[model samples]
Target: MKERKIALSQEDFAKINKAVQQAAAKGSKDSLILYRDLALVTSITNRTVITAIDGNNMAEHVFTNIDSAVIVK
Candidate 1:
């Protein structure tokens, strides 16, 4: 098996957190957060990321079980 790793700065994490908060405010239980080249599947109610997909893998990729989506600039 191969393992993939990602490094995020505090500021980047803060941004993602803010997005999650916004989703929660909108009554989203699950969300797809688009940040830069990463697509994160998050659980709004749980306040945690369920999965992440990079831009390279996003082509023709299908995301399931998400109730909302947020694009972060």
Candidate 2:
């Protein structure tokens, strides 16, 4: 597979970090689902976003292998 890059602002980065921390605290493991303006599928163990999808295309996709979800607006 081709390597994917997801650009995020400093504020978005901070928010994702915070959300990951909170999810970990709540006993989450493995993958983490984060929703900012777009949807992000992250690996908690790897500490990286595996993929991202814009909100407009979110409805047509199905997310799997996620242990928890965080919404940041």
What's each prediction's clash count?
0, 0
**lDDT for each of the candidates?**
0.89, 0.71
Candidate 1, run of 10 with poorest lDDT: 1-10
Q: Supply the global lDDT for candidate 1.
A: 0.89
The prediction achieving the highest lDDT against the true structure is 1
Query: Between which residue pairs do clashes occur in model 1?
Result: none
Candidate 1 wrong stretches, greater than 4 Å:
none
TM-score of each: 0.92, 0.75
Worst 10 residues of 2 by lDDT: 1-10
Alpha-carbon runs more than 4 Å astray in model 2? 1-6
